[model samples]
Every structure is written in C-alpha cells, then in structure tokens.
Target: MSAATVSSVPIPSRGWRNDMVAALFWLLTVVGVLMMTGAWFLLALASLEEGTEQPKALAAGTTMAGTTLWLGIVPLVFAHIAGFALCLVATTGRFDRARGVLWAGEAVIGASLIGLAVVLVLSGGQLLYTPPDYVP
Candidate 1:
C-alpha cells in the first residue's frame, strides 16, 4: 500500500478587487501629492511678494502662507511613506491590514489638501486685495 499527501495553498477571495482598490488609492494619493507641491510652491512665492499696503495684513498673510505650505508638505510626505508601507504589507499577504492603512493614509492626505485649500481661500482677501489708504 502507498500513501499520498496533498498540499493546499491559501487563495484569497476577490484578490483582484483588493488590487484594484490599492491601485486607486495610490493613484489618487499621487495626484494629491503633486497638487500639494504646486500649492506649497505658490504659497511660498506669494509670501515673498512685498507690495501689500497694510503692514498687519502682510505680516498675517506671510505667517499663514508659511504655515499652510508646511501643513501641506508634511502630510504629503507622511501619506507617501504610509502608502509605501501598505504596499509592502500587501506583498506579504496581509491584505486586511494594508487596506486599513490605505484608508487612513487617504484620509490624512485628503484632510491636509482640504485644509490647504481653505487656508488659501481665506487668506486670499488679505494677500490678493489692496486696502484703501486712510490718513491717520
């Protein structure tokens, strides 16, 4: 009599779906990062301008612009690093953990971008508009 043994491999259900989801997350995060970079650059350039008539407005605008630039860049870098880490975990067959990380990173990056946009819009009045001069 002869004995035989069979080995079973773990096959994930809907593996393609995970792949697609991860791909989409990466794509959106990449685009967000690029836009953040551009926004930071523009903020820096605007902060360098010296044509504002209102000294208080100019000072406030400069500080807000610098803060917004840092806020955008730091979150982008963190998101990128987190995304890469999630990819590594995925490759190791930890799909669940990877998915969770992807969502967290996406949220962080999204919030950062939205915050930057809001800051830019709110500061536009002080930075882009000139105030009327009044004799003191």
Candidate 2:
C-alpha cells in the first residue's frame, strides 16, 4: 500500500471493553473516596467527648455514616482492591490504551488509603484523650 493510502486509513483505537472496564474502575474509585470521607467524618463524630451536646441532625448523620461504612464501604473497598489486582493480572502483556487512566486510579486509591489511615490515627488520639474517670 502507498504511504498516502496507509496514512489515510483510520487507526483502530482501544477496544470498547477496555474503555468500559476503565470507566467502571474510575466510578468505583470515586465512590470509594466519598465513602472514605464519610467514614472519616464518622470517626470524628465518634471521637467527640461523650458530654458534648450534638445537634440531632449531626447525630443522625453519624449513625448513618457508621452503618454505611461497615455495611457498604468496607466491602466495596475490599472488592475494588481485588478487582484492581485482577485487572493488573489480566492485562499483563496486553496493549492497553487506557493504561494511564488505570495508573491514575491506582494513585487515587493509594492516596485515599493513606488519608484514611491518618484519619484513623487522629480519631484514635482524640478518643484516648478523655480521662479515666470521664463519664457520659
């Protein structure tokens, strides 16, 4: 084929499957980050002094956050991590045009995990700040 003819031919992009997988990965990542933030807020609420009065809405939100964190977010995060690992394995030696998007998702997950750890530590410190004799 002539160079002009070859150059004129459309180049095939990555398959729809890759795009779909990447989209799902990113959606899960966003959900995970939002959940982590909610969990961190719950931790902050839980660390509040027992005697401190909180608004009814704040109290209700805390309960909801705790429930969702335990029942939804935790499981989802675990599954997401597993899915990411599987994707890495499955894509081995394959040409992925969306590889950069996957890498960015990985970075987001790593950063969120680190932030969650920090929130946990800070909450722990706050919880432990009360005196032994302190009572609600």
Candidate 3:
C-alpha cells in the first residue's frame, strides 16, 4: 500500500476500551456491595442470637463474628469509594494496557484492607474476652 492510501485510512478510536474499563469497574462495585450486604446480614443474625442461652464457645464465636463484620463494614465502604475514584481516573487517562493493572491493584488493595480489618477485629475480640476463672 502507498503512503497516501495508509494515511487516508482512519485510526481506530479507544472509546470501546474506556467502556470496557468502566464496565469492569461497575462489576467490581456491584460485587463489593453484595459482600457488604452479606456481612450486614450475618451481623444481624449474630445480634438476634445474643439473648439465647448458648455455650461459652458458641457465645464467644458469635461475639467474634459480629465484631469482625462490624469492623469490616467501614473498610468495605471506603474501598468501594476509593475504587470508584481510581476507575474514573483510569478510564479518563491515556488508553493503554495500564488500565488493567490499575484495576488489579485497586482490587488487591480493597481485599487486603477488608482482610486486615477482620484479623484485627478477631484479635481484639479475643483480648476483650474474660476467662471463666477470672474474677472482677
């Protein structure tokens, strides 16, 4: 092909790439929302059993579950918000393979934050528990 013919051919736009990135971000948002809702449901179930006469082990387990879910709530919300911001930035910037990398990093950060929160909650809950033989 001659240089003039090649020059006349229009270049493909990157709009579709941006749209795909946006769709992926939306999917991530939806998943995050579902996870948050499930955690809330579990927390509610634990609260409902709070008044029941349960064994020490069962009660402690419920308490830890509730605490961990509660701790995770904030981080989950924050992660969603931050992820949305990053998604906007990625889609609007230069179109390249880097958008995929940004999405992966955002996902990892969100997951790690939630995981860390749960671990801290469990550890702190253990410290708050009293032994059967312990006096006031």
Candidate 4:
C-alpha cells in the first residue's frame, strides 16, 4: 500500500497466495524427505553407547514400527512434493509470479534441510557419547 512498493514492483493477484502456500507446503515436504533420509541413515547404521538400547529392541514394539514409518515415508513424501511443485507450475498461469514464489519456497526448503543436518549431527554425536542410563 506504500508508494515505493506500489510503484517499484507488481504484486501477485488471482490465487497467488494460494499458489505460494502450496509451494511452501511442497518445500516443507522436501525438507521432510531430507530429515527422513537422515533418520533412516541413522537407523540403518544406528548404534549406541555400550549397552545402549537398540532401536529395534526397544521395550515398546512401536519404536521399530515408527522408525520404519519414517524411513518409508521419505520417498512417498518426495513424490508428493515433486507432484505439488509441478501442479503449481502447470496451473498457476503466470510464469514470472510463480517463479519468485518457487524460488522463495526452494530457499526455505534448503534452509530447513541445513537445519535438520545440523541438529542431526549435534544430537547424534551427543547421543553417541552419552548413555541414557548415566544420571548422577
């Protein structure tokens, strides 16, 4: 509503926010895939401190089930994200407007993946070094 914003550039209209929201959702889905991959990698090679609880051998039967869910979901989510992006691109009708939103969404997706990586590495290292039963 300001002169600078109004005069300098054009804002999107006609379902622009809807398209952007869809893009953001898809971007988040992509990030979810990366997280699942990291988690699955951890599980596939998952080890722990001496006498640490094995993920499969957890006291609860649901632990391994949950792990399998997450691992299996990575690819399914990947497909959804890909399809979502393509849907937006094909249906949006405005290439220039959609492009900016796509770029922004992709940026968010990249940031999310980086954040996941950092958390995984730090927490994994800590878990590897510290045993859960060690409380003093």
Most lDDT-accurate candidate: 2
The candidate 3 region of ten consecutive residues with least summed lDDT is 125-134
Clashes of each: 0, 0, 0, 0
Across residues 1-136, which tens digit of lDDT does each residue of candidate 2 receive?
7798768767555543466655665565565566555555454554353224334447667532244445445655665565465445444323564674476457456646754776667666452224356457
Model 3 Cα shift for residue 91 (angstroms): 10
Cα lDDT listed for each candidate:
0.51, 0.53, 0.51, 0.50
Candidate 2: Cα lDDT at 107:
48
Best by TM-score: 2
Query: lDDT by residue for model 1 over 50-99, one digit each (tens)?
Result: 22423665666742334434544455566556545544443333346555
Of models 3 and 4, which has the larger lDDT? 3
Candidate 1 lDDT for residue 77: 63
> How do the predictions measure up, each by TM-score?
0.34, 0.36, 0.33, 0.30
lDDT of 2 at 63: 31
What's the best-to-worst order under TM-score? Answer: 2, 1, 3, 4
lDDT of 4: 0.50
Clashing pairs in 2: none
- The candidate, 2 or 4, that scores higher on TM-score is 2
The TM-score measured for candidate 2 stands at 0.36
Better of 1 and 3 by TM-score: 1
